[model samples]
Target chain A: MTAVESSVATLDPEEARRLRRERLERIGSWVLPLAIMVLAIWLWDRICVWNEIPQYILPRPGVVLQTLYNDAALLFGSLLVTLRITFLGLLLAVVGGVGLAVLFAQSKWVEMSFFPFAIVLQVTPIVAIFPLINIYVDNQTAKLLLCAWIVAFFPILSNTTLGLNSVDRNLRDLFRLNGATRWQELWHLRLPAAMPYFLGGLKIAGGLSLIGAVVAEFVAGASGQSSGLASRIIEAGYRLNAPRLFAALILISLAGIVIFLVLSLVSHLILRRWHESALKQER
Target chain B: MVPSTTVPGMEGSGKPLLSLRAVGKTFSNGVTALSNVDMTIREGDFLSLLGPSGCGKSTALRIIAGLTAPTTGTLDWSRKPGEESSVGFVFQEPTLLPWASVFDNVWLPLRLKGVSRSDAAPAVSQLLERVHLSGFENAVPRELSGGMKMRVSIARALVTKPRVLLMDEPFAALDEITRFKLNNDLLELWQDERFTVVFVTHSVFESVFLSNRIVVMAARPGRVFQEVEVDAPYPRDEAFRTSPAYAALCRQASDVLVSAINSTHGAAA
Candidate 1:
């Protein structure tokens, strides 16, 4: 019996088949999307070349790439500026959102009085508010940061509040039975349980923060040393430099994707060991 | 058959650790969960509050732990005022913190008492070993089975070495084999520690096998209906479980529970 088991274990056909399938699926996930993207780009270039499209109207993919390469210094500098705004706005939003959420969890009256204001901020379009903000705020960077922070703050606040309130009643009773102080309960029980919800909100806020930064920049139309990728897009549009415009757009889209990916990775790393959402479902 | 008794502080010859005098609870929504609950918990006694659902067994346990306040009664504690920390509670569910490792979950009560992790590690380790979870110290609650999670919960409750341990249907979610194993282990722990235990359960056989005295309760303004004494010798093993005495005690308790449950139905009708 032992000899038979050992021989079967060495050449397990079912195990081998499953491993091969898993490997193929893993490779196909990224490889397939990449191949499709390359093919689409090639087709786009072919169509532009075949039709003799004007560079001002519809530049070829190669021209767009060339424009990106030639203006790397200026474009990359603007990219850094845009990314800085995105990060800074997201940081401020997290601080404000989580801090307010803790206060809301502590007192109902505070939440009732201030939550409607936060809702008004979220629902009121940033574009509509930009002219008013620009009129009052002379510092272009601070105005952009405020707009971005407003856009990103609500999800974190709502999600964190829900997470804090959704604690298991049994666990809360246990904490009370142990004679835990209010601060201790909040710090130990509420905070750890709210982490996954906070991280989920962070991932969403990452994209919104970038959008907020770019939209605010476009509205401001600021040019010169402080200009971001959005401003580059506007400048390229005025000159009818379609390739450069495309390049700037691509850089903004890529930055948004990177932010989303980084936030997701952070969430996964923190929750992988314990949370139900992070656990792999077995058939 | 054991006679039904209503007089408080009548059972158990042991010295009283805590006495509940006319305890009652009425929620804000006007639901009376418990009413005129009078009982005396004696030191080193394994007392089971066996009742049907909605009999306020859990509420009674919670009130004892000071997690909930009684509406109309006094809970007089025999222990010193500063010894309020010497009470541990286990809920119906395992209630282990999913984020923490088994060691950390067991270390929580001690940590709350201002003991550092390093100082609490020895007690946590000893309790984990007692619960047969020695090698699973670093394992998260998610990694454990239902029974194992309950074991961790038990370990955490015992880590503080509380004089009174209140458990509310702690093994209700587990399978029969696991529940039986846990019951035996709990008895062993009780034998060794001699802590005053107020166990709440709905199972007659379980109460019969584990407790020296079982308090049968009724619902609809929950109150005590009867008290049954097992009068069985301790160091009970598989032989005791299979004995005629165990079966007889279970039969008596089952009869009391049935009548208690039926009385509520009769009153409603």
Candidate 2:
């Protein structure tokens, strides 16, 4: 083929190097935060008097680690409960969000009619409604769903709406020229093009669902007979068990971080092939 | 005695295949893009629409391709009996789907007709080979160079064996050497495929090198200003581009363009 025919074979090395440099810069910037975290953990252990502070009032990180080791069964059991609630809540949010997005995208009237309510739901604090929901819903899991849906629904709805609407004019025309039916256009073109945006929204919503689960559990004041990490945390705080309280807090943070990282990793894995945004440095 | 079964534009004999009737286009903002344009696009002919920027050359080609309906007038296609497909279009930009493989992009037209990949593989592969992208089937559009992408676009246009191929400045973006080489390959493809080509370009020499007829246009109420016949033989090469006939035609086209520009200036003044 002539050079015109083979034009797509060339790559810009400069652009590739710039992409590499950007990734390295990102890695470089994270080092300071890592260093500070390590230093702070070391100092907290060294300065705090482990024996002087009562066992219930203030346990050292070492002590919390020991407590974590000792109460692995209880901790793991509570963790499973919280995780179930989070997972179910997130799944429900995705279903609700995608359904609403399709409705809104298909018709401007529906988007206008239902959009204000979504905004209102988004703006209204989840913490305030937790008690009301908890009272109405005897099932703790149902209350957890309500809270998580409130937190997670907006991103999915907003992102999907944007994604569906952001189709290229040329691409739309191409579909038209090809005699593609409306359903074909939607399924083949709009959905695939919107995948990156949907994944982004999903990543944000994953963490939000976890937060919702924890907050709902907190307000419910669930008893340890069938309780979660949030109940244990509240119980520890009320009884002045400082190290255990910190230990519970650490568990919650770890859960949030793990959910966040997992979703981010999933988004990258799904989008890294075709999407420019998800592309990483070769190194 | 002739069989009379040969398609008008497909054989080496030159003849008009399509005609435009006082076609005009005006944007909603009241900008008249094309005004009272008249042209006959002949078969086995390389008709170049040559003009400066915003001359409505691209708009005219789009109108013919049925991509956009003209604000006024009708396009008449003198179809042969029982011909199923008629027109193919290549835009100024490559416009290949970045996500699709080279082979898939070329096979898009056939696929749209409900043809299976296996069924259309021979035609797709042959078209690819014609465009000189022999072994690059699995390569994505982004992986290819700019010129290579345009070739894929060309192959995509030709895959269905169109009667009329409309191109809007297909090589205007490339460097001089690349453009020159593409110009040569395009001529060869046209000779082989035997399809009528309406190529839009702004370069005077380019129009002279490639076209059987050059339709010169002027912007600001875009309209046909002049038409020049090249009267050159097929399989035109670099040698043909450097010949006296080519230089003379280029000068004639350039003069017509200059006069068109002067007339517009005079009217504006």
Which candidate ranks first by lDDT, i.e. highest? 1
Any runs in candidate 2 off by more than 4 Å, and if so which?
Answer: A1-34, A50-57, A107-113, A131-139, A222-226, A281-283, B1-15, B80-86
Candidate 1 lDDT over B74-135, as tens digits, reads 99889876776378888889998899999999999889879999999888888888899999
Candidate 1 has a TM-score of 0.94
Model 2: per-residue lDDT, tens digit, B1-269?
11122233333436668888899999999999999998887667778898888889989987887778999988888877887535788877887766678998898878877789999999999999999999999998777888899999999888888888888888989988888888889988887778888999988998888877788898888988877766666667878878898787778889988977776778641
After best superposition, candidate 1 residue B235: deviation in angstroms?
1.1
lDDT for model 2, on a 0 to 1 scale?
Answer: 0.82
Interface RMSD of each: 0.8, 1.9
Candidate 2 reaches a DockQ of 0.28
Badly placed stretches (over 4 Å) of model 1 are A1-23, A222-226, B1-13
Worst 10 residues of 2 chain B by lDDT: B1-10
Work out the TM-score per prediction: 0.94, 0.86
Tens-digit per-residue lDDT, A1-283, candidate 2: 6785556346477766787888888897898789899898887776667447566765667999987888788877888888888888889888998889888878899999999999999998998877687668877678787898899988988998889888887667666666767677787677777788888899889989989888888877655433788888888788787776787788888998998899888888877666788766554
| Index of the highest-DockQ prediction | 1
